[model samples]
Target: KRSCTHRYCFAVCIKQDQRSRHARGTVPTSKERGVREEQIVKKIFATMVGSSSSWSTALVKISPYTFASIGIAISIGVSVLGAAWGIYITGSSLIGAAIKAPRITSKNLISVIFCEAVAIYGVIVAIILQTKLESVPSSRIYDPESLRAGYAIFASGIIVGFANLVCGLCVGIIGSSCALSDAQNSSLFVKILVIEIFGSALGLFGVIVGIIMSAQATWPSKG
Candidate 1:
């Protein structure tokens, strides 16, 4: 009889232990596990959705004025650098050639003028961009219109800057060649000058395009 009673008590203790484990969630049932997995999936989905929206909002919050300023700086800075580079290369060649043929001095000045014009193109584009920049209220800084305007202005500046930079280098190299050729044979001066004129026109093309691109970029007003 005592053995039977002991066996029954042991069974009751095992059952209690099992019940406690289930109640404490140490052993989750299939249904409970599925519910947990669903909750985890929902949380992950919510997190992914939140992160995606935050990325877009962060992009939109970027200051348009900052990009515009950088654009303007690049346009002027790169154009000036190109012009200076061209002038340096051409001037050295021009001075050397002039020493051989003094008569070509005045005529070869055209090349220098063309190089200088590249810098002017940058300045013109920069001015246009500057004018397009307006003081906007804090509320409009993240507006879609403002973002569009900023991007347009930045693109315009980049287009003008790079075009002028290339144009300047082309003119300078060609100008140097022209000076040397003129010293050797005066007839080559006009032919080479024609090519230089075409090279200079490349910068003009950039200016026109930049102007057109920035034309529609207007900052939104508070009103």
Candidate 2:
């Protein structure tokens, strides 16, 4: 009976040890599980708040085609405006001066026609610019290279337009004065023609620069 009691007590001790081990293991496992759950919640909340990637991507997204079209229009339209004003200013003066001096009709007509030629120059430049430009693809907005190209072309158009505008107006004024002076004193026609030539030369400056600037402005695809 004493031997039996010793065996039974040993069995009870063994069972208690197993139960304690299970309880200790369960506690650590439960703690690990709670930590994992907290981490998951944090990640979910962060995602729900706006992330940097979407905003950054949108920042670069702009319409390159819109700017390019505007550039083309500016190139043509501004040139036309300058030319029309030049022609009107010179033509009206020529007509008035011709009435006062019938003998100077040929000289005054030449001055007015020279002013009109400014319009022709603008048309020619506009055609060249338009030809150089390629149509923008509808599928894409602004890519890096295309955006750079658009900016370059836009600058070219603006520079050319403003330069031509100023030169055309200056030349027109000079031409009108030339017509009147030539009517009053035919000897002054040659000297005034020189000034008008200089004014016309100013417009050519923009055309040369624009051609150079637009030379590399091909529609960018890869970047």
Candidate 3:
């Protein structure tokens, strides 16, 4: 009877020990926690990177300046893409038109060049945004407060890029038609030029908005 009682007490003690270890999130020296443990952060790398305990908990410690930079890059990249695509459309039409009507070759070529200028606008905005974004020191950790500015900058870039992109595409289509129509009838040239100017104005709107948002943003700098 005493032996059976001793056995029951041992089982109970083992159960209690298991519960305690589970609560404390500790493992026995001989056992492993399996796959989940594999992705756990390494102590050495974490220590070398930064001292913030929040870094250990968070999956990504992205710097706000990184977002701002992405915005700046996007502004330039998307805008250029639009401008290039626009120029291609306009230039193709211009070449085809010139082949049919040599008289329009000099005058209609300016339309294509004008479309190419839209991309240059993107370059200007990107440079301005880059100037606004200050670099953080390597020794200092990113500030949480800067996230608002980062988001604002990012949104501004998107707005400018897509706005310019659409504007450029619209202008390209109109310019292509204008080039073709102008070749057929020189009288249509002035009217189409007016439409192209209006199309170019769309990009200016994006620039204005971007400038406003970028002005409000201030990148964090190391003290």
| Worst 10-residue lDDT window, candidate 3 | 35-44
Lowest lDDT block of 10, candidate 2? 36-45
Instruction: Please give, for residues 1-223, the per-residue lDDT of candidate 2 as tens digits.
Output: 9667655655665456457767888433666656755655555445555567777676457566556667777876787778778878888888888898877777666655665666666666667766766655665446666776676677777777777788778888888898888888999999999888888888788878877887767775533
lDDT of 1 by residue, 106-197 (tens): 99998999999999999989998999998889878978899989988998999899999999999999999999999999998899999999
lDDT tens string, model 3, 25-109?
Answer: 9865644433323323343235446657776546246767777888988998999999888988988888887887988878877
Model 1 pairs whose backbones collide:
none
Residue pairs with backbone overlap in model 3:
none
Q: Tell me the spans in candidate 3 whose CA falls farther than 4 Å from its real position.
A: 1-60, 137-142, 220-223
Using TM-score as the measure, name the better of candidate 1 and candidate 3. 1
Backbone clash pairs for candidate 2 read none
